[model samples]
Target: MSALEAARRRQSWSKVTPEAPTREQLLPLVAAAGRVADHSSLQPWRLIELRGEDRIRLGEAISRVRGDDEPSTKPLRASLLIAVVASYRPSEKVPRWEQEAVASGVAHLLSLLLDEAGWGVIWRTGDYTRSPEVAALHGLGEDEALLGWLYVGGKPDRSPGSRRTVDPEPLLTALPR
Candidate 1:
């Protein structure tokens, strides 16, 4: 299948196995993801790779943020957790929001790439994702903010099901003369 076709077939697999792409396998994909439309070339984004015991620590932090003694198993669902951080650079030419959009685009691209590579991937975000405690845990800078976490692992035995089609006409608009 073509790259776009593979991307379109991509589905978020909630239940995945522990098998995941190695750092060596992911480096090329990361490089491609970084080649996004970065205005002013600010490169206003970064990624934090979490694995093994780190996931456990993150789970604990998440539980603590929720005031629970028991740690969450959410982070353990995936073999790898990539923390997408939007490091906004102060720029008069490019606004912070635009920079954030660029970061988001890069994330989407990465997700597509992972899917194309036969890896089950999901982008998860919640109130805890934006928690200052979580940010500190991930070692994010004061100017940086968490976008979300990309949970990646091996595809489950079950199929991802068919891809749903959506019409874009309603969401499209042109300049009115």
Candidate 2:
């Protein structure tokens, strides 16, 4: 399919089946995603591919932090989670925000690629985004931030419905300077 067509067809798939991407498959996906725009060629992003027992361990951590609201099926549902970390090594050449933008771009491309490969992906981040404990688990430095946890799996029979229409003109427009 054409690049525009592939992007337009991308959708948010919530309910996923049992299938999950292997480590080998993820390497290329991550590599392709890392090509996103980086203001200073400072590819300030890292990915932690959690699978097998690792996913359950992460769910346990989430459960510990969540107390009562912890979803019992989190471990079962999220068999593979790709944690996107934004690494901002202090750079005098470029602003920190620009570095963060690079990380966001990486996550965006990764999500699109996963969806195109017939997999469901959900980018999740809450209190854990700022949690030191969680950062330690992912080996994040002081200047780093946890952008999101990308939950991936096969698209289930019943999943989150497609997004409704929105006026394009208002959302996208070039302002004359």
Candidate 3:
């Protein structure tokens, strides 16, 4: 399927197996997202990959913050976990929010690319995303903030169902005369 077609078919898979793409298989997807529009070319984003035992560590950290014990499998739904971080840079022309938007765009592009490649992915975030403990886990800098994570793995055996068609007519508008 074409890239756009694949994008149209993309859906958030809540459950995925332990199989995932290797670094080699994922590099291209990462590179594809790098081409996203950046007003100042600040590239205000970074990715931290979590695999194997690291996923468990993340669950432990979350449990620590919540004051409860979470299952080790909680973070293991997907074979790989990619923590997307928005690292804003000092810029007079570009506002911090815009920089963060650029980062978010990159992440969406990455998820689209993964979906196109027959992988299941989900963009996950919550209150813990901005927590200090979570930030420390990824070694985020002062200017960096955790946006969310991408849980990715091979597509499951069951069908993902048909893509929903969205009409753009109502959402579009031309400049007033």
Question: How many steric overlaps are in each model, in order?
Answer: 0, 0, 0
Across residues 1-177, which tens digit of lDDT does each residue of candidate 3 receive? 777787777788888877898999999989999899999799999999999889988888888777786544567778799999999999999999999999999999999998888789999987788989889989999999999999998888987666678898987989889
TM-score of candidate 1 to 2 decimals: 0.94
List model 2 lDDT by residue over 1-177, tens digit each.
666776777776656777899988888989999899887788898988877787666666666666745633565566788888888977898888888889988998999988888788888777856777667767888889988788899888774686766678888879869
Highest lDDT against the true fold, candidate = 1
Judging by lDDT, tell me the better candidate of 1 and 3.
Answer: 1
Candidate 2: where is the Cα deviation over 4 Å?
67-75, 174-177
Error of 3 at 65 (Å): 1.8
Question: Weakest 10 consecutive residues, lDDT, candidate 1?
Answer: 1-10
List of clashing residue pairs for candidate 1: none
Cα error, residue 113 of model 1, in Å, equals: 0.6
Q: Which candidate tops TM-score? A: 1
Runs of candidate 3 with Cα error greater than 4 angstroms are 71-73, 161-163, 174-177
| Per-residue lDDT of model 1, residues 69-122, tens digit only | 899989998989999999999999999899899889889899999988889999
Cα deviation at 26, candidate 1, in Å, is: 0.7
Task: Point out the higher-scoring one by lDDT: 1 or 2.
Answer: 1
Q: lDDT of each structure?
A: 0.91, 0.79, 0.88
